[model samples]
Target: MEKKIADALSEIDGAGRVTVVLTMKAGSRRMLAEETNNDDTSAVLVSRGSGYQETVTVQELSPQYQGALVVCEGAGDPAVKLKLVEAVSALTGLGSNKISICKGK
Candidate 1:
């Protein structure tokens, strides 16, 4: 996760050698949709090869983000800081208050 964010931030203009630390509020979760028939509801199943079956997945949810800290050479610049904040918010569903951008080597 840190590597992914670092790679993404490295693309920003003047954002050199980015490093990211992310804190999660919770782990990834998923919802399994149910199927209804004859007024009865039950778990949906997906058929597979060789008569195998598996539970049908309805939705996959990303982890809840607690906060993020971004370190980069350009973080001292207001523009770079703002961009990094916005990018981290979009990627991790974190608000600006939860994101900290700091200048680093």
Candidate 2:
């Protein structure tokens, strides 16, 4: 996710060598649910499959973004820094105060 944010921010005209450090209030965890199987009869059947089968799932969670530090070239300029702050705020649903921008090393 940090890499994606850095890639997005690096597209700005004045942004270069972008570095983004993300801080989260809590880490995301998986949700669990109970499942039951009632079949008790014993029966054996074997079948050959030609291809692999896999199940993939994507789950959405609430925001955990607490803050972030962004360092990039030309970020020393007040205008550029402000722009970066706003951009980060919009992307992360965080207030400007939570996002900090500084000039790249």
Candidate 3:
């Protein structure tokens, strides 16, 4: 996540040498679609060929981010800082209050 954020932020105009730190509220977990019948609860299975049963994967849930810190050479500028904060928030699903933007040496 940090790497992704850095790469993304580096793309912004004047956001040079971006660095990112992220805090995760919870680790990612998978959600599976299940089959419930009366007293039985089981994973929904799909048959391949000749009776090969495969568990169905609904979707992969990404980790929830609590906060983010971004340091960039251009962050001293208000516009650059705001852009960094917004980009980080958009990528991490966090609010602006949870993101910090700082100037890098």
Candidate 4:
């Protein structure tokens, strides 16, 4: 599952973007990644609230890759958070888990 998600994220083109919000027992965090097709490309992570109220925001979009968003809930765990990001990234192409975000370009 993790690999699937990573692959999806990695597959995004330079103009593509992906956003992910993770809800956890301890808190919530958000991550955003924009595909640059450059090895230096990176994603941004944001955090808000604590425990149930916690949330994460991520914005990854561009002309090439387009834009995508994903939301996940689970106990606070590093691995889980990573998985959520990967899952959301994979959704861009496979559309698995019915995860998608319909927002601006």
Candidate whose TM-score is highest: 3
Q: Which has the better lDDT: candidate 1, or candidate 4?
A: 1
Those runs of model 4 whose alpha carbons end farther than 4 Å from true positions after fitting are 1-69, 93-105
TM-scores across all candidates? 0.81, 0.68, 0.82, 0.22
Residue-by-residue lDDT tens digits, candidate 4, 14-61: 213333432222322335454455577644434544633322345433
Among residues 3 or more apart in sequence or in different chains, the pairs in candidate 1 whose N, CA or C atoms overlap within 3 Å are: none
Candidate 4 residue-wise lDDT at 31: 56
Note the residue pairs that clash in candidate 3: none
CA deviation > 4 Å runs, candidate 3 = 37-39
| Over 4 Å off, model 1 | 33-44
In terms of lDDT, which candidate is stronger, 1 or 2? 1
lDDT of all predictions: 0.91, 0.79, 0.91, 0.40
User: How are the candidates ranked when ordered by TM-score, highest leading?
Assistant: 3, 1, 2, 4
lDDT of 3 by residue, 1-103 (tens): 7998899999999999999999989989877889999999999988899989888889988999999989889998999888898888888899999998988
Go through the candidates in order and give the C-alpha RMSD of each one to the true structure: 3.0, 6.2, 2.0, 20.3
- Model 3: weakest 10-residue lDDT segment is 24-33
Q: Which candidate is the best by lDDT?
A: 1
Clashing pairs in 2: none
Q: Report lDDT (Cα) of residue 44, candidate 2.
A: 33
